[model samples]
Target chain A: MITVTGTFTVKKNKIEEFQTGTLELQNASLNTDKGCIEYKFHQQQDAPENFFVYEIWDEMASLELHGASQHFNKFSKLLEGNLDKELDIRIYNTI
Target chain B: MITVTGTFTVKKNKIEEFQTGTLELQNASLNTDKGCIEYKFHQQQDAPENFFVYEIWDEMASLELHGASQHFNKFSKLLEGNLDKELDIRIYNTI
Candidate 1:
């Protein structure tokens, strides 16, 4: 399996907006994408503006498909110009 | 299951040392910790000095024990003053 972790620094005021869109994207990915084992969004306990998405996929193809999904594109558009930095994402092979 | 994601920004020159210590810590946690379902370290592809550790545990008690283990203490000491910033850790319920 492949695991994906993405860290985002959302503007303080856009937290509610980001969460709403992320929940929709997450639901779509899990419900519609094959091999999407897990996909969840989280807010840092201490830092409200810091967000993370942790995902598990059966393989690289599934992950790539997730990136290109309609939900993902819409989510990306929602995030445009609303971040402190570009998304910091890392993909790793599960041990 | 519970998921954990930690981001660490390591000094450029300490990459090798950090990875070595981290590998030992990871091996110990998985091999010895009772409920450590997954523990894997990943280096960001675009940024060499940035590292992430993704973990899953069976329960909160198990995670707490893992945190207080000998290997964890060793790892903590190894990380003292060696990072660019304090470790950023977030915990979330698995979906």
Candidate 2:
């Protein structure tokens, strides 16, 4: 399995907007992607603007497909200027 | 629930040792702690020396208690000098 973890920092006061868009993308990924095993989003408790996304895919190919999906494309467009920094992503494999 | 994400970098040539110790601690935490909801460990694919730990507890107090548990203390001692860097932890709440 391929696990992807993304740490994101949202623009000030934009958490609600960011979360809504993320939920839309997350739902689409879960429903439309055959290999998406898990998709979960989390918000930092101390710093509300920080977000984390944890995902599990069957393989690298499935993750690539998810990146190219329409919902993801839309989300990328929506998040263009709403982020505090570039996404910090780390890909992992179960040990 | 309280969610904690910790990023770790392990010393070279010590992943096997680290993983074994970690698995022991993880199992102990899961089986012995009533508040531990989930405990998962992941190894970075590109950087095999790096690790990520995802944990969920019933509340802040449970997390505190877990930290004080014997298994955790033993694991901490085992991890001393075995890690390339201090654990970078972030606390989050599901949104």
Candidate 3:
């Protein structure tokens, strides 16, 4: 299995938009995408603008597909100019 | 509940030692720590020296307890001089 972690810092004014976009993408991935073992969105307790995504996919191909999915693409556009920086992404395999 | 993500980079020659120490900590956290719902370690596939730890705790107090546990202290000692830098840790709550 592959694990994916994404760190995002949202613009203070764009929290609502970011949250909506993230939830849509997360929900679509889990309910519509295949091999999506787990997908969830989180917000830092001490830093409201800071967010994280923790996802588990059965394999790399599944993760690739998820990225190219329509919902994913739409969500990306919805987040334009809404973040402080490019999403800091990391991928890993169980040790 | 709380979610924690930790990023660690091992020294070039310390991979073996880091792995052994990390596994010991991971196992102890999952098997013995109270309110620890999940604990697992991962290695970045493209960067073998990079490691990630994913953990879930029932509450803030439970997580605090984990930081002071004997196993955690022992694991900390074992990791000294093995890491390239301080572990980068991020904690979050579900949104």
Winning model by DockQ = 2
Task: Rank the candidate models, highest lDDT first.
Answer: 2, 3, 1
* Model 3 lDDT on a 0 to 1 scale: 0.88
Query: After aligning candidate 3 to the native by TM-score, how far in Å is the CA of B8 from where it should be?
Result: 1.4
Span of ten consecutive residues with least summed lDDT in model 1 chain B: B86-95
User: Taking the tens digit of each residue's C-alpha lDDT, what string does model 3 give over A29-91?
Assistant: 999999999998998888879989989999999999998999999988866788886788898
Tens digits of per-residue lDDT for model 3, B1-95: 89998898989798877788889999999998889999999988888799899899999899899999999999888768788868988888877
State model 1's lDDT: 0.84
Give a tens-digit lDDT track for model 2, residues A1-95.
98999988989878889889888988899999979999888999988899899999999999999899899899889778889988998999876
Which should have the higher TM-score, number 1 or number 3?
3
Ranking by DockQ: 2, 3, 1
- Candidate 2 CAPRI-style tier: high
Best by TM-score: 3
Per-residue lDDT of B1-95 in model 2, one digit per residue for the tens?
Answer: 98899888989899888888778888998999879998988889989889898899999999999989999999889778888888899999876
Listed in order, each prediction's TM-score against the native is 0.72, 0.95, 0.96
Per-residue CA lDDT of model 1 for A1-95, tens digit only, reads 87788788889999889878888988999999989998888876567677888888999899888889899999999889999868977876432
Model 1: per-residue Cα lDDT over B1-95, one tens digit each: 77788778889899889889888989999999999998988776566677788888999899999989999999999889899978977886532
Q: Comparing to the true complex, what docking class would candidate 3 get?
A: high
